[model samples]
Target: MDTVLTLAADNLLSPLILFFALGVLAALARSDLTIPEAAAKTLSLYLLFAIGFKGGVSVSGHGVDGDLVASMLAGTVLSFSLPFVAFAMLRVTTGLSVVDAAAVAGHYGSISIVTFVAATSVLESAGIASEGYLVAVAAIMEAPAILSALWIAARFSADTGNPVDARDRQGLLREILLNGSIVLLIGSFLIGYITGEDGLVEIESFVVSPFKGVLCLFLLDMGLVAGRGLRSSAKHLRPGLIGFGLLMPVVGAGAGLLGASLVGLSVGGTLLLMTLSASASYIAVPAAMRVALPEANPSIYLTMSLGITFPFNLTVGIPLYLSVARAVGG
Candidate 1:
């Protein structure tokens, strides 16, 4: 308990979190602080490329085996199935319409890259080594949740109208599979794998040294976005919905712990998996939601995922996951 508290304290005081806090405060106070859209996009690209490339390099060094395959498969299964759990919970706990619930559930099931990156930073600070192939797992986890959400919406909605009609199917598939984030992540991973250590070495200064600084800036932007969402969308965030946002991550992390144990992930690897599972997609899933469930309220899902859940995971949840993973995985 002491160790967990200490970790949480340390994380809260870190520059990345502190910058994010600054952004949130600035936004809430109606200050003029802002990151330009173009710069934010560049930072996002850099983080994705660096993370994916590093993972590929790690895979190159470690080589693929049964564990990599098993973990990816497990992650996909978790991604596909977690929405059902979330949807069921929502139905019991909130008065959300089927479409809204499924859309929100899909966000829960999908992974947040920023959260995953934060978990990696935590692990690195602790001098822990995790499997590199988890990047691939992250990529694989993105699309399946979207698919599951669509399926749930189609199957259970009081209205017979499919959220995704035949006309929209091809475009939606392309959006999911070829989303710029996914493409950059997978492409950079493959490049890193093909080029191996030599590639990393050649570009180490670019991708390695500035990674943390870039992440801090990116998170500042995130905090700004989240704060604005919360300010504008507070009326939409009811008690039941807020409670769901708080509780669901822990539930998802519990499932992740089980999956990690089954797949025999290492302590660091287990923590990453737990982090991935606990995260809600503010990026990919939200974009897909806009296309698939046009009637669903963006304010609700965005606020739930980014405004509430993201902060919780960063401040409290990461430490909890690390402690649990160490206890069980050690």
Candidate 2:
């Protein structure tokens, strides 16, 4: 109970969470605030690269463990399987079509890097240390959901269909598998691993020491994006879809908790696992969906995931997971 309260109180005051709230409030109140798409994309690249390099540096120093392998396997399984579960639930609960359902499902199955970063902040604030290889686990979780969504599209989409074409299919595959974000993230991680402390030294002032400060700037932009998405989605959102959006994270986190406990993860690691499960797709999956499932209403999935559930997680869910993981793991 003390741990829960501590986590909750600390999370409430975090800059990233506050920035996210600013976005939500601005959107809810119909503010004119916005972030340029190019700038937002650049920030995302920086974040991915910074995190990937840091993770590689940590891993290079510590070396991978058997437990890391197991966790990666678990992440892959969760990525591929969660979509089917989500698709079925969305179909039963909402009026979303099959393609839309699958697209949304893919988002849920995939991991959200922002959420992972936020969780990292939460855990670090509490002085809990996590393994670096979770970065690789995150990378593994991003792509499989695309395959699942495509499979669902082939099997169930109606004639009007998505935006995909034969020529774009190969490109889409490459994008899903080798998105610039993923490439940079993995590449930076490899560089860090190869160079270790010496390599990190060359870029330390830019990457390591200034990380949290940069995160604040990034979250400010994230706030702007979330607010816009929320404003765009306000009318399209319905009670049922919103319910699914909120409930899915809980369901995913519960599964992650069980998995994490079984794997005997550290408190920090468990929190991260819970976060990866709890996070809803907002970035990569949404872009992929915009390309592959254009018929699906962007306002519904993007808003619900980013505007609604994201705030919920940043403000409430991270602390909730930390509290729950400790109680269960203790």
Candidate 3:
């Protein structure tokens, strides 16, 4: 417990989190600080490429094995199933309609790339080594939740009038699978795997040396976006919704820990898996929701995922996960 608190405090004070705080504060105070959209997009691309490539390189060295296959399978199951749990919880805890609940559930079930990156950064800072294949796990986790959410809506909701046409459904599938982030991440991962250590040597300075700094900047933009959401969407977030946002990550992390234990992941790998499971997708899920379930409220899902869960995961949840991993993983 003490170790958890210490790590949480250290994380809270880290430059990345602090920069994020600065953006939130600036947004709240209306200070007009903003990252250009194009620059933010470039940063996003850089991060995906770097992390994916590094993961590929790691896998190249480690080679494919049963453990990697098992981890990927476990991650897919969690991604497909977690939305059901989240949907049930939402139905019982909040007044969200079946469609909205399913939409929001998709966010919880899908993985957040930024949050995954943040957890990796925390692990690196703490000198913990995790599996590189987890990046592939993250990519695998992104789409299944959308499928589950659609299934839930079709099965449970009788009256939304099918906002998604067959054409829209096909487009949504493409968007979910071929989103810019996923494409860059998986493509770069393959490139790195092919190039291996020699590639890393050639590009270490570009990807490795500047990673933390780039992450700090990206997080600042995220903070600003979160702050604006929290500021403007307070009306949509009732007490039940607020509680759900805060509660679901812990629930997801517990499910992840169970999966990690089953797969016999190491402490660092366990923490990363927990973090991935606990994260909510603000990127791909929302776009899918917009196309597939256009009636659902973006404010509710986006604010819950980005404004509340993302910050909590960064500031407190990651440390607790690390502590729990250390205790159980040993």
TM-score, every prediction: 0.98, 0.92, 0.98
Candidate 1 overall Cα lDDT vs. reference? 0.93
Q: Please write out the lDDT profile of model 3 over residues 48-142, one tens digit for every residue.
A: 99999999998899898999999999999999999999999999999999999999999999999999999999999988998898999999999
Error of 2 at 255 (Å): 2.0
Which of 1 and 2 is the better model by TM-score? Answer: 1
lDDT of the candidates, in the order given:
0.93, 0.81, 0.93
In terms of TM-score, how similar is model 3 to the real structure?
0.98
Candidate 1 lDDT, 1-330, residue by residue in tens = 998999999999998899889888989988889999999999999999999999999999989899999999999999999999999999999999998999999999999999999999888888999999999999999989999998898889867355567879778988888999999999999999999999999999999999999999999999999889888999999999999999999999999999999999999999999999999999999998898888777888999999999999998999999999999987
**Pairs clashing within candidate 1:** none
In model 3, what is the error at residue 170, expressed in angstroms? 3.1
Q: How many residue pairs clash in all the candidates, one count each?
A: 0, 0, 0
Q: TM-score of the candidate numbered 2?
A: 0.92
| Worst 10-residue lDDT window, candidate 1 | 158-167
Per-residue lDDT value at 87 in model 2: 92
Candidate 2 wrong stretches, greater than 4 Å: 30-32, 158-168
